[model samples]
Target: SMFVTNSSFCTESKECLEYLLVCKTDEYEVRHYSPTRWVSTDAEAYFMGVGAAMAFRRLFQYINGANEGGFQMEMTAPVLVKIPEETRMWEPAVYSLGFPLPAAYQEKPPAPTSNKLYFSEMPEMDVYVRSYGGWMLSVTSRLHAHLLTEELGRVGASYNHSYHYGVGYDSPLKLLNRHNEVWYVSEGEGSFTSQRLV
Candidate 1:
């Protein structure tokens, strides 16, 4: 229903539905990649806490209208991040937080005042998704991602590791029933199927 920005974690927002499940977990759903406009910058590992919040705020204001494209856009799930690699941990790593504009606005969305922002469309594709709970601390996010990777490997699924996504659906203010996820792009060409994880 509304989006609230807090740098310690992903941006917060409310939705009429309990945050779209996207697809059933372990279900191997094929979803058309949605379109989102995002901003990217390098942040030292130690500063991810504050840096991320600042970046989100800048982008958030673009839609909220610090310039011209002023509209209270609905926030989307799994604040997609191009999950960084550990070997480069000591050095500054790039983080991207996308605002997946609704399809109607996506084609002609407002321009961001900041050059740090960019827009792109996610092509339709199949993906492996895993759900988790709790705050998205670096360690916690990494663990869920690792588990998702393991599950993909166990199922003999092909995945692209260059990028991994972390999705969050609950506001930090909400204390219980929080939903977060780790997503991997699937390499399979067949039509998407929903498989029960159990």
Candidate 2:
């Protein structure tokens, strides 16, 4: 049996939670992130094929300690990707991918060999999430993101347009019961727009 940690740090809707999922797929998630109080407002939709691979490779090297001491770091859960609106067949729009690390290592993460890869501590947030199964493809990401946006509108739930996030758990080889999520941040108390969702 795999080691399981806490469940449901952020509240979820019935539909969000009911979507079929497999837990314990990723590393230990660190809930407390500092400095970066909230997700930024930017629309970066990574291109599908090599874009994703190159992005991951960059981070992989960073975590593998391509830095000064060569001190390899651990991996974390829910490799996230932010999708874009416009896309073509097999050639998806520009997007971004991310990996979370345990809080213990956040204080002094190894220096990144590549400037593209950097350490960030994400703050707690309220987001509208849509859960789904299967591999995270460009088409799938767009479809679910649309579905989630529509649901929020239908429910009259107010949200900001920070930056939408694609949360993916599990590796490629693990076919059955793959878990994925797209997060739309909720509107903050002020005049903050969320580029993530809208």
Candidate 3:
């Protein structure tokens, strides 16, 4: 399966989530992802970093034998943090962090022991993607998302602006060539099929 073939940026993991690139230009790319399952947790805080940190720990535990069957699994590439587009200074935003389930466990992932952890079933969909380097901090993620949205608007592409994904492909321990991405869900323009690689 394509999931077993890691892209250049996904050096930290043996397996990575796969997507079919539909189109690419100077500013952004369009990719189609198949339905997949993941282990996920949510955290709410004034900043994305705070929320992601809280949520990451729980998801980490689940992968580190914190499941009902004590199934310890290898980490996957490009962990996803779903960030809401709308938030006020006084109100906290919810960040949902998820780790893609390995192909072996996709059909029957071990149940999480913690109540805060749950399974996420992502449906087949198309997304507008923008790549970046450096750490996926809240500021960088938001900046890139803003830039991508501007380009999408210029191209007259319709997308779901309510939320976006902050994707990280490298671990914090790695200091160079870190790869990240911001994704906006495409609306009605994603029904076409393509097989281009990332």
Best by TM-score: 3
- Poorly placed runs, candidate 3 (over 4 Å): 189-198
RMSD per model, one decimal? 8.0, 8.7, 4.9
Per-residue CA lDDT of model 2 for 105-145, tens digit only, reads 44555555666655544444455667788888767876788
Model 2's TM-score against the true structure:
0.68
Task: Enumerate clash totals for all models, in the order shown.
Answer: 5, 13, 0
Identify the leading candidate in terms of lDDT.
3
Per-residue error (Å), model 2, residue 53: 1.7
Q: Among all windows of ten consecutive residues in candidate 3, which has the lowest summed lDDT?
A: 189-198
Superposition-based RMSD of candidate 3 using all C-alpha atoms, in angstroms: 4.9
What TM-scores do the predictions have? 0.72, 0.68, 0.93
lDDT of the candidates, in the order given: 0.56, 0.53, 0.86
- What digit string (tens of lDDT, one per residue) describes model 3 on residues 1-198? 638566878888988999998999989999988877778888989999999989989988888999888998989877999988998999998888888888889888888889888787777889999999998999999999999999999999988888999999888899999999999999865432222111
Scored by lDDT, model 1 comes in at: 0.56
Q: Give lDDT tens digits, candidate 1, residues 1-198.
A: 222243233435432112223455453343434223333333334444455666667666766765345666665544555565453646666665655554445457766667666665555456676767777766787888888777777778787777676666665578876777677876765332222111
Deviation of model 3 at 115, angstroms = 0.4
